[model samples]
Every structure is written in structure tokens, then in C-alpha cells.
Target: MRRIAVLLPLLAIGVLAGCGGSSSSTAKPVVKVSGAFGQPPTIKIPAEKAGGSLTVKTLIHGTGPVLQRTDAFVGNYAIYIWSGTSHRLAQSSFTAHRPTLFAGQLLPGLETALIGQKMGSRVLAVIPPKDGFGTSGNPQAGVKPTDTLVFVVDMMKDFKANASATGTAESNGGKGLPTVTAVNGAAPTIKMPTSKPPATLVTRTLIKGSGPAVTKGQMVVAQYVGAIWSTGKVFDASWNRHQPFNFTIGATPTQVIAGWDKGLLGQTVGSRVMLVVPPADGYGKSGSPQAGIKGTDTLVFVVDVLGAFST
Candidate 1:
């Protein structure tokens, strides 16, 4: 989970009631949140004692799908701890210009606040110590045992584990590129070209998605198959695991290989893109022996962008 800038350790939470209503039967604080959906919010915390129970308020209702605890989602958040008159900021995916992947990896309180909520909504939750770090306050984030945690979240996108790409198919312009065979929403098989591989990185879109264009510092969920160009052997395939792959698209040293960072940028969500990666953008001189990749082997990947989420 890489922490992903959270108030507590990255983890999952349990499910709650249905969406479209605030939680009752709990004594909550008076926290004000003002912001548009999908944008950074201005949260005003009361300079008073903590709340007695978990409290959830939906600032802006969304028209998207209702989220479930089993589903994976992406959203931007701002966290703070309230103790007496001192309110301090802990972490914010909004400030980082990136969204966190809420794949059941989050604090229990925060997770409970999100489940059953609709995508594209703005939620404010005030969690007491019971649902937060409990009796042992999180010293790493400077929280006291009695301190209450406040979270402002902007829900962006949600997807099931088996979600696939949906877009308009386009001609692959098959000139010097490998042939891809995709059927029945399964993994696409790649047949290498007889000619030599390209010396540099090459990206071709087999499907042009109408969704938002993928940008840097965004979490991208996709289904992909990676093969060595020369032997045409599949080194990796997300479809085989029956789960989509997710990573933060960024510079080479960050979440994924350099080839993915460069080739996937600006690609629209739901597009099936083919990437021809040279050695420099791959594992470099020290190839991945475990994956049977050599230093000079050019790699080929067929990627289906399922979704993209940003701050």
C-alpha cells in the first residue's frame, strides 16, 4: 500500500449500511467542509473535544455507482487530528496531487465512512479513537489516545475486480508491430513480428477510450499482458490472476517500469494500448533473471486501461 499519505497505517475496513444518508445514533462533531466534487476541499474543524462515536456526513451527493467494501476505489483525502483547540494536518492525497487506491487497505474508521458511498461524492468523517488507532494513539502522526481523526474524502472512481475496458475499437495500424488477439474480455495474446524490434519505445492504441486521459501522479487500473518480443513468451498477465493491475503512473524510479511511465501517460482510460519497450526503459542492464528477461530483449506489452483516478 506504500502508506499513500494516510493518517494511520494503510489497511482495510468493514462495510456498513446503504448509501445516500448520514449516519445516525452517533454523537458527532460539527465539522464544516466546503468544496466541489473532485477538487481540494476546505475543512473547518471545531476547536473542541472529540466526538463520542463514528460520524459521517455527505457534503456533496454523487450520482455514480454505490460503493461496496469488496470493490476497489480511488479518491483524494485530507486527514487531521483534533485534540482540544489544536487541530493539525496529518496527510492529504489532494496536496500530493495524487489519489489513494482504497482497495480495502485503509483504517477501519475511514473505510467504514467510504463504503456504501457513491462515487464522485464528498464525504466528511469524524472518527473517535475506538475506530482510529484505538487506545494506543499513533505517535507517528502525533495523535493522542483521546484525539479524534477527521477525514475529508472526494470519491472519484470505483471498479470491481473483473472490470474491463470499454471503448471504441480502432484499427491497430499493424505495421511493424505485433499482432494481438483479444477475445471474450480475456487476456490478449501477442504474436511477435518477424522483423527486428524497434530500437526505442513505441506506443499504439488499439482502442480509443472516451474516458479521461491518464495523467502523471494518478493511480491507473488496467489489465495487461507482457511478453518478450524475441521469444514471444508471456512474462506477466493480469488477466491470468483474474484481477486487474494497479499502480501510480509516474517517473521511472517510482511505481512501475520506465516504459509504462512513458508509454501510458496521456492514454485515455479504457484504451487498449500496445507498448514496445527497448532495454533502456525496462530492467536496464541488469535484466530480471527471475522473469527470464535478458539485457537486450525488447519487451512488448498489451495493456487495457480499465480506469484512472486523480486528485
Candidate 2:
């Protein structure tokens, strides 16, 4: 768990004055500004008064509105600190608790930017060190005395008003199995058993490497190939030509379908497993068109558990 300490002292205070208490008694501060990604610093300003362009270079697949605290939002995220050519710090989707930012639990800049964002909105906020960790920087963050941060946040869900229901789905019950039905070195076909205790048991110890076995709350990096079981139509695959998908097992909650969660449980690290995920555990009735999956689709996946990280 990466602890993002709240450093309010360094935050610039932008105050706004309004009319007398004849009608309204409170005075709200309003600040505004703008810029592009990777640009040099022109001046230091308070978060409430700060503003800028997102200038998205790559908008990964997402669904919904930009997340905002005012409107209520909750989800997992990945953060990375970047220096010229290297990443200073990085944290992937390792959240077990659906952090709630209702009032003031986040940085001023983040809170201001995230408020009003709709559900499923993925955003890339280019934050200067000033609006972020400030000059002294976050010692705990390993952020150097001088470093800018880039946060690639994926808003998986928003349950500002309703937390209990979403929270329950996020902490999936712990009991599932990895099923293998096909094999192809880098990408294999897999299936997740449906029976409440998973009646089917298929295992393949392909090219075993020494490491810890896959655990419940660990992060795993994997390459996979998925297709509809009935028609053998390819749906989604990371082995084609893209970065391997990374996820903290049981951390994403409903980010992945039930079938995927059940299929990946209890697999050893560095081993390839195939799974057959039924529609009930998959996308259900709302199949993804982009992936060519239908309501009654049965998914076949080949998962290569490249690595696992424990906290």
C-alpha cells in the first residue's frame, strides 16, 4: 500500500471575497489557470486556482464521466513518478479497500480535479511538483527533491452515495480455480469453472520457474488470449502485441468479470493455465461488442502468470 501523505501546509491558499451576509453567509474560493503536459514550470500556484489541459496522448478503453470528489467517486488507481527518461516511482492496482474521497481525504489538486467526474471515466492528470508534492517533495514517496508526477488513473466505479453495495462486490468471496483448455506458448486459452466449488480440475505445469505460489491478495502480471467457447471467436488478447495486463488478484473487485476472478484463483506463479468461463461468470447479458462477446458467450482464456508481487 502506497501511503500518499496529505501535505496541506505546502498548498497555496486562494481566497475569494463575496457580498455581505444578507443572503449568503459563506464565501467560496474560485481559482483558474491552464497548460499542456510535460511543459516547464512558469509559476507556483494554489490548487483551487490551478487548471490545465489533460492533452491525452492515449485514452485507454473506459466508460463514464471524469471522476470528481464533489459529485462523489470511488475506485482504484495506478500512480507513477517520472523523471526525464525513467520512472522514479510506480504503484499499480493494489487496492483492497475502495478508498472514499467524500470530503477531504485527497490532495487539493486531485480533489479539485476529480470532483464532478462521472463513473467509468479514465483520466491522465499532468500535475506539477508544486501542485503535488511541492519543493521538499514527499520523502516517503521516494520522490526526489525535484521530480514531476504523472498519474494514470482508471475510475473503475463510483459509489459516493452508495458504498456498502459496491464494497461487497469489490471483495469477492475467496474460492475459485484456474482451468486450462488450450495452450500456445505466450498466449493460451483458459476457462473458469462455474460450479460452486468448481467441479472441473485441469492443470498444466508448463515451464515452471522458481517463485512463490500465487496468493489471494498479491499482484500478478499476466499475458492472456480470450475467445468465445462456442464459436471460437477471438475476443481480447494481450499476447497479440501490447503490454501485458497487470492486476492485483482480488483487488480490482468488479473491474473484471466474475469468471475471470474465479478462473485465476489458486494458480502458481510462472505457470500457464487455461480457463473456460461461462457467461454467468463472464459479461453476462451485456456482452462487449468491441470484444465480439455476446450475452450467451462462453469464454476461453489462456493465462500465463508471468509474476506475482506480495505486500
Q: Write the per-residue lDDT of candidate 1 for residues 1-311, one digit (tens) a residue.
A: 11122223422221121112224334645888887876778888876776677888888999999997667777778888788777887777777886766663456677777889999899888887777777777665566778877888888888776666688888553678898877747788798889999899999898889999999977788888899999999988877765566787884347678889889999998799999999999888887888899989899988989887663
lDDT for predicted candidate 2 compared with the true structure: 0.45
How does residue 266 of candidate 2 score in lDDT?
Answer: 74
Model 1's C-alpha root-mean-square deviation from the true structure amounts to 5.2
**TM-scores of all predicted structures:** 0.76, 0.41
Q: What is the C-alpha lDDT of each candidate?
A: 0.76, 0.45
Worst 10 residues of 1 by lDDT: 11-20
Error of 2 at 204 (Å): 6.4
Candidate 2 deviant stretches above 4 angstroms: 1-210
